[model samples]
Target: MKTLTRKEFIEQVGIGAAVLFVAACAGSCKKTAQGPSSVNFTIDVSTGNLATNGGFLVQNGVVVARTSSGSFIAVAATCTHQGGTLNYSSGSNQFVCPLHGAIFSSTGAAVSGPTSTAVQKYNTTLTGNSLRVYS
Candidate 1:
């Protein structure tokens, strides 16, 4: 059997490391596009996070939020930056991407980015306990 010398082993390790690094970066930086198109859905806001001001929930690829002022907003649930799942911050009335600190307004405009594109926004309406989200 052949055995590698120290120089040969180091070179092999370096090459392997470079390959792994490239793969990791490619996967990590890949933008994830998710959410509904021609969006139309209903959620009962009488319970769960949607029931209260400054609360939120994600359903059917939409992030729905109730602002501190008791109004509702809906936006795509995936971050435009790298497909990170978005979280609604009612305190700031913004959608935030956990992966890269991307900030988006409740209307789905990109406030900051590793992404230049804005997430699509959906229209929201409330009737009794039924909240409808649509494009």
Candidate 2:
């Protein structure tokens, strides 16, 4: 049988620890990037494609949807359940999380989902072509 010397064992342990450290770092780094906890921004609704009804835009991790009635709504793009990116369904007027089928209403209310918590909503102001959304 082969036995490792004390010095050799120490070197192997150090290498193993380094490998484990690198692996952990890589795993943690692969997480989905989250947006700012708080948002404050203004958008020109008149100039961009968002001017039309049912138009939606994602900026700063916020989803701004222009409803069919020509009104603007803003909600956090991240899903409350699992931080999945959200999409607006104009046909249903709801936000859907692609991760786990979580659904939210236009008012950021939790309609149906794995999570009972509602997504964060932002206040919006529309004046002429300028639209402001803030948390």
Candidate 3:
């Protein structure tokens, strides 16, 4: 193999770095381009899993929870305090962030913790066996 001169080596390294930077930027831009927005989806609750009270599921960055009365509620799954992902607690009827211990009520209201801003809530409707969650 032919050895690269000092100047040729620097040029090749610079080109490789530029290519890598462009590739990284392209991948990140694709993610940021899709800003947060309302999402609508249909789920079949006839299976009896989500149909029961206290059932919950997270999909497409949103959390869908079934209340004790069998009512469905949807909200953003990310904590408002530090953008930490939240998990639903069936026993406490709230969403808890493991990162900072932030807690949000079932209605997405910031109940107790460092965050005072409530998470974005979506409206949910049940028609027969179909459940739709939307903004």
RMSD of each: 9.0, 9.9, 11.0
lDDT of each: 0.87, 0.85, 0.80
* Model 1: residue 42 alpha-carbon error in angstroms: 0.7
Q: What is the lDDT of residue 61 in candidate 1?
A: 87
Q: Give one digit per residue, the lDDT tens place, for model 2 in 37-81.
A: 678899999867588998898899899999888889988898878
- lDDT for position 50 in model 1: 90
| Clash count list over all predictions | 0, 0, 0
Between prediction 1 and prediction 2, the one with superior TM-score is: 1
Off by over 4 Å in 2: 1-37
TM-score versus the correct structure, for each prediction: 0.73, 0.69, 0.66
TM-score of 2: 0.69
User: What's the lDDT of the predicted structure labeled candidate 3?
Assistant: 0.80
Model 3: runs farther than 4 Å from truth?
1-35
Candidate 1 vs 2: which has more lDDT: 1
Candidates, ranked, TM-score: 1, 2, 3
The collision pairs in model 1 are none
lDDT of 1 by residue, 1-135 (tens): 889999999999999999999998986874433467878999999999999999999888889999999999999998876789899987789999999999998778888868766788889999999999998
